[model samples]
Target: MIYVDPSGDDSGPGTVERPFATLQRARDAARPGTVVTLRAGTHRLTDTFLLTAAHSGTVYQAHGYGTPYQEKVVISGGREVTGWTPSGDGTHRADAPGPAPRQLYADGLRVERAALSLDGHTLRRTAGGYTVEGTGPQRWDGDVEFVYRGAYPWSEGRCRVASVSGDAHATTLTMADPAFAQATRLYHSVLTWEGPGAGESYGVDSPTSVENSPAFLTEGTFATAGPVIHYRPRGGEPPAGVAAPVLETLLHARGAHDLTFRGITFADATWLRPSTPQGFLHYHGNGYYDGGALETVTFAEGQGQVTVPGDHASMPGNLIFEDTSRTTLEGCRFVRLGAVALEFRGAGAGNTVRDSEITDIAGGGLVIGDGARDHRVENNHIHHIGLDYRGSPAVLVTGARDTVIAHNEVADVPHAGIVVYEGRGTKVLNNLVHDTMRVLADGGGIYVSGPQGDSHANGALIRGNVVRDTITPYNFGLYTDYGAAYVTVEANAVHRADAPVVLTVWPPLEHVTFLGNVWDADPGDPPGGVVLKDNTTVAGDAFDSDPRAVAITRAAGRRPARHRH
Candidate 1:
């Protein structure tokens, strides 16, 4: 077995006795049957590690080792930033090694993107920017961002501050980027205005934006002025608590078989999205129907499902396994990364992500089965994701066949829970999804759409899942939108939702089935050629009830464990 210790020398022989200091040396020393073990400590990664078929092992055997939940092995993508110079304005400045990072951590915890309050103000969209009335507390530092809370379906408005004008009574922010159509203000007022989209410290009841102006500077807020990061501690300590992200991806496995990433931890990576306009899987209504490409008011041209994205969504991830079969990412923790955690795409069949925890990420979590087949996403807990976009799913699976999404526990997310779009024979079963639509609207806990255009989704299975506490008015517990056909919704429990189920497409949906399911509330009128049979309510509890309606007071989301490996 080849070994890697953080304290070892890179020039060593890579043996356990003469261990190597870096994983690259250990990986280079490994053969088809070789095993590489990482000694428990932090391994900082400045670049992505590629695992190809050259690194594949025998069938049902693993080539990499860290001991599942038994080791404290961390593969970090962030560099330590020390040598803080107090700027005397309640903030400290530090020079970093690489390009400036959009995400930073202090005291071993993820720091908040800067923001200020816009409470008790009126906002107006302008030709050049958006202006806030009754000027709140927002102050512009070297540069600041204008972000907003979405009141409409699938909306988030974010732009850099080009100029800040007006007096203390009112402030007009000339945005560097145009607002998204969904982010544009509807009618007059909204629940609140928001920006920079940070967690917790970002308010819930008031208008909030990340402000860097000296007037809004306080402890625990970090922003960039050219190449330096400005910070202020909560209690005014030394700048030792601050850390900045530098790298893009952590572990990237491509076209390898029988590889296992067991019990590894990935932390502190940054993925700053490009300032291009991006949208969700669906356009709600007013779509072009052909699915060729879409153009929004601001995001005009070149938007399609397999089409390359214009921004950081196209960047690499923390743990990426692609085009490999029988590969497993088991019992791992991916935290505080700037991009997606655990993405499996491109023709990797029979891959599995199980017993993992993914949280505190800026993008989507645990994406698998893009054109891949027979993938399993089971028994994982994913939460607190989409730190930037308000409409990203926790677990997104698209363009794959015979993919199984089962037994996952997803909660507290910004948007939807599990979204299965495109391909055929996709099964979503027995997963618990709650507290979704926490930020954006018009989504589903278990949402299914796509094949796009005149094409339709066929032979999809959505069953035995429990979804609750959906916060938005348009988000449902389960939904099939954009001409999904021949899909089956059966034997599930969905409650505490804006609506239990929604099937809409103008002329309505076709070839959809609702059987043996339990809903807290029935879906409104469906379209032609829809079938609803033996579907019950929350009173009957799996027993037969009234002639017109049945009551199901408890969750019907029960199943026997299926081990498909």
Candidate 2:
């Protein structure tokens, strides 16, 4: 056994009376089958703490399990900012001299960045960059950015400002190198869409908002210069504590097995790669391409087909477990993170994440990538994710095999709730997903694309989920798009969506079955090679009182989650 406390000494023996100061010291002193007990306090990490193959069969737990006095444990990757002086304009200034983080927290609440909406401005694409109809931001410290939607409703991209000039009638904004060229290439790549409203498929072309500028600083926002950090107070109240993320990875392990982490909270980590010169070029469902130029553009037989190398790379997770097996995380919390919360990658098998909470992130929640098998994620609460990058889903499963994602509550996201793209024998069952696609479009509450094994053999199953309140412009309740094949969607209840189910016919879905489902809106027609059997449509209040819908809603989302105070 080993013990760790935040107020203890590092030179002491790892005992209950005299504990080790850091987790690293207790981990180094532990054996293979040891239990490392932690006292209740904050353990702020400057770098990632590691556990490799030598630390198999280890358990990290709270100070007292199954007791009344079990307090909270926090493992944070944030650095506290001191010496905050009042700037006398209802603002505060601190001496922070580094790359600015994408997220900030004041007294454990998320703070918004400085922004100005450009909703009514006319922005025309010029040779260098763009020409705005009104006067642009003229007093920036060289890191002003534009968060804009592309021509496709499913895409969102960002770029930096190099210089801004011209008169009050129109200002010419010059974009930064390489990122501007890469974003323009992706925006003009989609040339054809045969399905509904082909001519009216253009979404917003101009930027909706400009971020990270001093000119846009308001009463509830914060901004950063080269060596100074500026924050405007909300309603003239001073904050008790202020912290910003500094490290990227909080935990990274490879080739380990049989580990457990219980009753802990991981918080405040930042990822700065998206703020680089490459920028963020979002595609769909956690796939982003930053590889400068398109590999191939073929207009021969397929007009809008651009060949990526392997369907683009996914965003890296901040806490990664590679080639690990038989791991478990229960009653944990992950908050104020800048990237994906957890990832299982590279020959991983038989892992489980249950009864946890993941919230307040800039990227996706939980990602099980390729080369993973037989994992289970259930009974968790995930909310308010994709706060910066709007294209990421709450839970994304791609190219994994035999995964089960069931009985979780997912809400308050910008994109899809759960997305499965090219996985085999995966089961998504009994989840309660709502208020999704709150910003972007063309995704659904639960979406599936690409093949999932053979139709006659082990295929995919999406069963008994309750999805509701998808109020986006172009979205569906249950969607199967982009050449999806070999799937069964059964007994699900969908309400208040654009449509119940959107089965795409462009790439032409094949061998898909929708059986015994309940919806508020009727799916007009089934596409070719798809089957719809015994589905019922209830209108208005009648849908809420239906027996099948009542049973499914009652059984879903039993566990609610809370943040660590």
* Residue pairs with backbone atoms closer than 3 Å in model 2 (clashes): none
For model 1, residues 212-286, the per-residue Cα lDDT tens digits are 444565677777766777877778777775678788777788889987666678788776443223222222211
Q: How does residue 494 of candidate 1 score in lDDT? A: 75
lDDT of 2 by residue, 1-565 (tens): 8889999888999889999999998888888889999999899886798989998889888877545777789998888777888867888888663467677788888889898887776788765578776665555553678787644577777777778887867788888767676666665545465765343222225677878876677887887765567788799777548888888899887899998898889898888866776777677777777664456444443446443323466788888999999998878898998989888988899998988999998999999999999999999999998998888899999989999999999999998999999989999999999999998998899999989988626788999999999869788989888778899999999999999888654567899999999999878788687999998999899999999899888887736533221
Off by over 4 Å in 1: 58-69, 87-90, 119-126, 130-139, 163-173, 177-215, 275-316, 451-458, 505-507, 539-565
lDDT (C-alpha, whole model) for all candidates:
0.66, 0.82
- lDDT over C-alpha atoms for residue 487 of model 2: 90
- Give me candidate 1's TM-score against the actual structure: 0.80
Q: Each model's TM-score? A: 0.80, 0.93
lDDT of 1: 0.66
Candidate 2 yields a Cα-based lDDT of 0.82
Q: Per-candidate RMSD vs. true structure?
A: 7.4, 3.2
What clash count does candidate 1 reach?
A: 21
